[model samples]
Target: PLMYPCRFNLSTRSIHELAARKAIRSLEGHDLKDVSEYTDHNSEKYKKMVEWIARDLDVSTLRYQTADDMIKAIGRPKENLCLYCWTGECPKSARPKAAITIDIVEVKPDATRTKEIKVEL
Candidate 1:
C-alpha cells in the first residue's frame, strides 16, 4: 500500500481539528496506525515542492488560520493538489486520505468584499 507520513498536530484550529477528530472517531475501533517510512529522507522531489510552496504562499499573500492555510501555502485558491500526487505517488493507487481540513474563516479577495457562506460538502 502507498503510505504517507503525516502527524496530527494539536495546535491547529477547531474546524480542521473537528474533521480530523470526526475522521478519527470514525476509525475508533480500527487497527490502523501511521506507518513511518520517510525517515529524514531528503530528495529532489521534496525540495521542488517546498520551493513551490514558498513562492505560492508569498504570491497568495496568505496568512493561514486553518488546514487551508497549509493548502494555500502550496496551491492556488480553488486548486486541489492531491496528497498522493504531490508526494510522487501514482494517483491511480488508493489515495491516502488526508486529515487537513480547511475552513475559510475570512477572505478579502479585493477591496469590495462581503460575507460568504458555503454549505458543508
Candidate 2:
C-alpha cells in the first residue's frame, strides 16, 4: 500500500485540545488517577503526543494524493500545473491574472438531420 502524507490548513492545537478534553471526560469515574496532566497543552511532551495523534487522525480521515501523483495522472508538467490543492505552495505563473470565458459547440449527426448544441464556459 502506498502512503501519502496528509496536508491541510487545519489547526493542530485545536485538535489536541479537543482530544485532551475527551480524554479527561472519559476518565471521570476512575479512582486515584492524575488527569490534570492532560490539561497542559503547552508542554513539549504534550505537543509530541498531540502531533502523533493529529497525524494519525488526519491520515485516517482521507486518502491524499501527492503533487507528483497528480502531475502523472493529469499528464502535465509541474511548472504548468496549479498544485495548490495537493501542495500548499502555489507557483506564481499558475496564478490567474484575469477571468476568461470559452464557448463550445457540439454537433450530433443523425441519419437525415444534424443537431447543434452550444455550451458556454
Candidate 3:
C-alpha cells in the first residue's frame, strides 16, 4: 500500500508517513521465496535486509508500533478496525485506556476575572 500510491506523495507527507514509506520500500525488490526458505529461528537475512534499508533511509531511529498501541491510537472498537496487517488475527474486543482529566486555569489582567476549566483526555 505504501509502495506505489503512497510513495508518489512522499514529499507531501509528514515525517512519520515518510518513515513508513521508507520501511515498506525497503522490501521493494526482495525475493520473498528466499526469505521463506530461512527458518524463523535464523532470521539473519531478514534482519540484515531491514538494517540495510534503515541505513539507506538515513533514519535516526525507527520503531514499529505494537498491535495494542495501534488499536489504542485508532480509537475505533477492535471489532470495527482491521488488525490483519499488524496481528494477523482479529480481536473480538478492544482494551482501550481509561480516560484522563485535567484542570486548566485561566487568569485575566483583573485578578477577579479568573476561570477554571476541566478538560477530559
Candidate 4:
C-alpha cells in the first residue's frame, strides 16, 4: 500500500463542510442535489474542493497512513524526511528563494534558423 499523509487547511475544511451539509440535507429529504450539481467545474471553488478531496484521498489506489505512522515506518530522523505536506513545516533550505530562468537554444539540421526556449525554475 502507498501512504502519503497530508495536512488539511481552511479550504479543505470548507469543502468537507459543504459536503457534510449536502449529505445532511439529503438525509433530511430537503433540497437534495446531485454531486454534479454542487458547483460548476469552471469555478475556483469547485477546483479547490476537488483538489482538497484529491489530497485528502492521497491520490492513491492503495491504503493510507497517518503522519505519525508514516514517520515511524520510515525509521529515519524527522529532520531528514520531508514532511511539509503532513506537518506544514518546511525547512528553510526547502523553500524557494526566487524564480530562476534559463535559456536554451535548439538548432535544426534541415533549417538555417535556431529556436530559443526560456525555462523557469
Judging by lDDT against the true structure, name the best candidate: 4
Model 4 compared with the native: what TM-score? 0.27
Give the distance in Å from residue 68's predicted Cα in candidate 2 to where it truly belongs.
0.9
- Top-down lDDT ranking: 4, 3, 2, 1
| Residue-wise C-alpha lDDT for candidate 3, range 1-121, written one tens digit per residue | 1111221121223423433345434555532322232212236643554565567769766444444654565554556543433333323332234332221112234641212222222
Among the numbered candidates, top TM-score falls to: 3
Order of the predicted models by TM-score, top scorer first: 3, 2, 4, 1
State residue 18's C-alpha deviation in candidate 4, in Å.
Answer: 16
Residue 102 in candidate 4, Cα distance off native in Å: 24
Q: Cα RMSD for candidate 3? A: 13.9
Q: Which digits, one per residue and each the tens of the lDDT, describe model 1 over residues 59-105?
A: 54322233344456545343333333113232222234543333222
- TM-score of every model? 0.21, 0.28, 0.33, 0.27
lDDT of each: 0.31, 0.36, 0.37, 0.38
Instruction: Write the number of the candidate with greater lDDT, choosing between 2 and 4.
Output: 4
* Candidate 4: tens digits of C-alpha lDDT, residues 4-121: 1222221233323444334334444564333333234455544554455555557733222444665566555555444543344643333455543221111234642222222222
**Candidate 1 lowest-lDDT run of ten:** 1-10
Better of 2 and 4 by TM-score: 2
